[model samples]
Target: MKDEAFDPVRKLVAPGTTVIWRNTGSADHVVDSVQFHDTADQWQFRTQTLRSGDSVVYAFDQEGIYEYYCGLQGEEMCGVILVGDVSLSNSLPCE
Candidate 1:
């Protein structure tokens, strides 16, 4: 991920896929999970403050719409992960 934005603001993957995010910027960045929406797929996850060249890996094991943002940048630098076929009503909104 870059300082201003994630390379791809959205992603579609299988349930077992492992996502690896790298900090390729000149500053720090982090990925933090958004609040849950009362769904079975909601799980807490976050990465430590990532310095330049640092990376984080997360494995999504359920089918759900997972929303997250850069902890350092908040909503201004956010993204969504769509695991399998998820119901729109089952996830928190992200943009």
Candidate 2:
């Protein structure tokens, strides 16, 4: 992760794979699932503020699109994770 954005901005992973977000910037950051907007109490993925060198890991158990953003940076620092079949290579197009 950079100071203002995630390195790839988009990622594709197989179901049950573990995803890790490492904070490589000088500031603090947070990872919040976008699908939990209305049901604030039911968020499946949320991370505590992570300073430089800190990291968070999450395992994607279902096949679907997961959207997330840095709670501190809002839209300026966001990314998408697509959990699907592992047979498809990383170069495969999204959608």
Best by lDDT: 1
lDDT of 1 by residue, 1-95 (tens): 88778878778899999999999998788888884455434568888999999998998888888878888887778777779986545433334
Question: CA lDDT, every prediction?
Answer: 0.78, 0.72
Ten contiguous residues minimizing lDDT sum, candidate 1:
86-95
Superpose all Cα atoms of candidate 1 onto the true structure and report the RMSD in Å to 1 decimal: 2.8
- Per-model TM-score versus the true fold: 0.82, 0.78
What's the lDDT for residue 9 in model 1? 76
lDDT of 1: 0.78
Give me the candidate number with maximum TM-score.
1
Q: Over all chains combined, what TM-score does candidate 1 have?
A: 0.82
Model 2, span 1-95: residue lDDT tens: 76878777778888899999999989889988774233221336789998999998998888877777888888668777777842222321211
TM-score for model 2?
0.78
Distance from true position, residue 73, model 1, in Å? 1.0
